[model samples]
Target: MKQKENITLSVKNVSKLYGDGCAYCAETDAVLDKNVCPECRTVHACRDVSFDLHSGEILGIVGESGSGKSTLMKMLYFDQEASRGSYHISDYDTSQSNVFGLSSQAKRQIRNEILGMVYQNPVYGLEMDFSSMSNIAEKLIAAGSRNVGEMTGTGDHFLDKVNIPLNRKFDPPINFSGGMQQRVQIAKALSNYPPVLLLDEVTTGLDLSVQADVLELIKEIQREMGISMVVVSHDLAIIRMLCDRTMVMLNGEVIEAGITDQILEDPQHAYTQQLVYSIL
Candidate 1:
């Protein structure tokens, strides 16, 4: 694996392959091993994906569904392990530190302290029964914020920072509007104050107005927080507005990566050009 110079987060030749084709599979006995591991055919969610994220830089990853966008984001969040290559955050080498393959305590520590994630589906990531404040406070608490008052204060601050109204803090995510819920989720992500942020299809299901607002909020937060960001989105307009650099993925491979303006204005790869043209 080749190293990228002075990068906060770097991924080299990473790949994720899922299972042999099967219609039905039996459940496993262990909690972690719930899915059956087959050895017949394999499907690659991500293939030889490589990229670098410098401190305070926003790198946008664009692709169609099943093109490995979400899978790649999951790997960043340590939700799934990469089958090949390595990733580094700050001085921590993911492959060497047992970062992904770690004890629950170790994994939880790294996840809470170093990384923050804003998922595509807000409802899916959030607790429907808990208030937005509770959802946000949980992550902060896990990340080492002790006092309830402090947690609540920090949660409120983040919610305000993400532009979610304070009045909605006690409301359950299910009760809030889609955009509002997404904002609350963003607040939760920032509550821990992680140096690296991963956003996956956050604005996909939003309306035009909400999308604009959400994108703006993200941009403002990135600038203020000065954290490295990896945003996975299919929306070209959002990418153009928010990203400093862009990577175009096709069929689970990165076809192009360069300055956002250069790729958007004059893409070199045929697939990149096609994707940009289709959206434009």
Candidate 2:
């Protein structure tokens, strides 16, 4: 596959620490547990993470529950602050800025215009009590769109795209099935037509059949929209299906990263080999 010349997003040396930066936390050589500082007890949720996402590429970050994949995604979407790092969106600025340094208002603008996120749980991304149309409208409203007619039309279009029938467009997500709710979340995320989409375990809690359908929907969206995506999931099957490139994370570090097929068929890292074998 040929890639475009420009990079969409670049992340360098990103780390998220839960405690104050004590001197002991800085000089620790504890290889066995990089996340825990034996001297100061600072928990490193993500440590020295770095990657580049090109336009129209789907990059997969795969790890277990505590491997910090979710933490990385949170940082990308501004849900959590990074202790140290630089994040740059090429379309927004040529110079990399610490995304954590941005003001709350600026961050909100970035979230509304530049980035779209779909969380593992629909509750985080959608209002259970709000109608599906209203849920999609919330994003447009946040982006300063006040035209009721336009918002409703856009919501209906996206809901249909996600296979949520027009009748359910007015129904609240609380009354919908898990799969339907997930689709609505996807629709809400794509409603803004953001340049980057961040998906965190979107199919984890769904049934196997439902998972397949959601996966297919995601692929279809990616194909039609050509949006760059960052997908974080514990399921290797999801990563294999959605990602062009894969990053294997363990203990808050990327142990291996490369083409998805290469990572699965010829895993070089011990942890990645274990993961691949376990799945097989």
Candidate 3:
């Protein structure tokens, strides 16, 4: 889609090469000979990738594993820096913010306040040992909210917003079902009220029935919070339900992107069409 000044996240010329191999040549080497191996090969996880994430819009990144969807989300969360190019959040140049270059304090500030990440692995991002309320409150405190009571209050409020009952607030995620844990994670992600929410396959392990509920909760929360989101998932149905725009990626590049309905209804790219068919 076209870039806009209202864009909350702008990634331009962003590329990531894991080792010494160049991005283009690495692909060339993989293609001509399937068995060919390059030493310390540069694995281009993301290729000169560019896209705009507008405010209050849920932009879904759909691709199979190894397709760079996760890597792109990592870059968005400032979990990793682009090997080349830059990402700008709001008016601040993320490139200049030096996702990798920032001081520990600066990076922490960005992470704790500006961006919130929900992972496919529930246990990975949240405090498994803590109660849902405790986990959420901790994040709010770290984000510079000195009012502990207020943070706790907001935490409970968000939990309810995400449909987590007050009775379960003190339960650790370990005892919760996959769906409930996901809800708690979503609550924690929003506790600090970050401007951006990055969800990496947040529905990976749920059954179809559970997935639907979680997806609905996400839509409701997104609508209420009015924060931008990047949802990474291979599930076309989920993406179709949640995103305003959807981007199709393959081997680290965005092959197609447009309004969710447009891409789902009339895909322009062959790969995109293939994905839509697969969904059918």
Candidate 4:
């Protein structure tokens, strides 16, 4: 795999606020506390989050629940609108653009052609009643692929790549086990070969054995495809296994970030140290 030196995705000064910015909300830096004003009642889902993802790199954002890691991922994938900031993908242009400024049409194009997302819950990513092949084909159709034969062939290829049985290609995901459903989700996300992939707690809720297998599959895909990925998870073990660099989030703010090994072995932040030790 050829990993480029260029920056792939750049996010700066991103925040997501859920309430009208009252005077208190405007002046107070409540993000570190992830607090809501007693009077204004604002929820800062993500606060001033900034990071650069390099080409062919897997960047992990790790945090406990309500730490805003998922919120940040949602902002990147356009599932939630950021209150402020610039988001730039080098493939789109060298100059940074305010992603929220783009029209709905433009965002849709970006989602279809430039980004792929695998949600934590299979239901969020897969159409349960649809066959495994159709689930993958839907993404291709959205990207303007029309030939049924080509779509089916492409679907089969990815299914095989993810180690899904070819015989089950026509079966609905509802009939599959938890691990198999996730494999189907992975196949669908990669069908278009997008430049960026967003995975949110991808292996959470799986059996330990299944989690290991899925992690190995993810590693294999990264090795083969060289796609840039933002993996959001609370599991430090998973982060250590998959990411080149890591960012530690706490209460809607990034408290620490560095190479994965450094962050895990020599954590400077109290929260990060606690996380690393808990796993040990």
- Each prediction's number of clashing residue pairs: 0, 0, 1, 0
Decide which is better by lDDT, 1 or 4.
Answer: 4
lDDT tens string, model 2, 80-191? 8888989988656533676668898888888998899999999999999999999999999998899999999999999999999998788999999999999999999999
Clashes of 3: 1
Better of 3 and 4 by TM-score: 4
Candidate 2 residues lying further than 4 Å off, grouped into runs, are 1-5, 28-34, 93-95
* Pairs with steric clashes in candidate 3: 21-42
What would the per-residue lDDT of candidate 4 be over residues 168-276, giving only the tens digit for each residue? 9999999999999999999999999999999999999999999999999999999999999999999999999999999999878899999999998899999999999
lDDT score for residue 218 of model 1? 91
| Candidate order, TM-score descending | 2, 4, 3, 1
Regions of model 3 farther than 4 Å from truth: 1-3, 22-40, 91-100
Per-candidate TM-score against the hidden true structure: 0.87, 0.95, 0.89, 0.95
Candidate 1 residue-wise lDDT at 33: 19
Winner by lDDT between candidate 2 and candidate 1: 2
Residue 40 lDDT, candidate 2, scale 0-100: 73
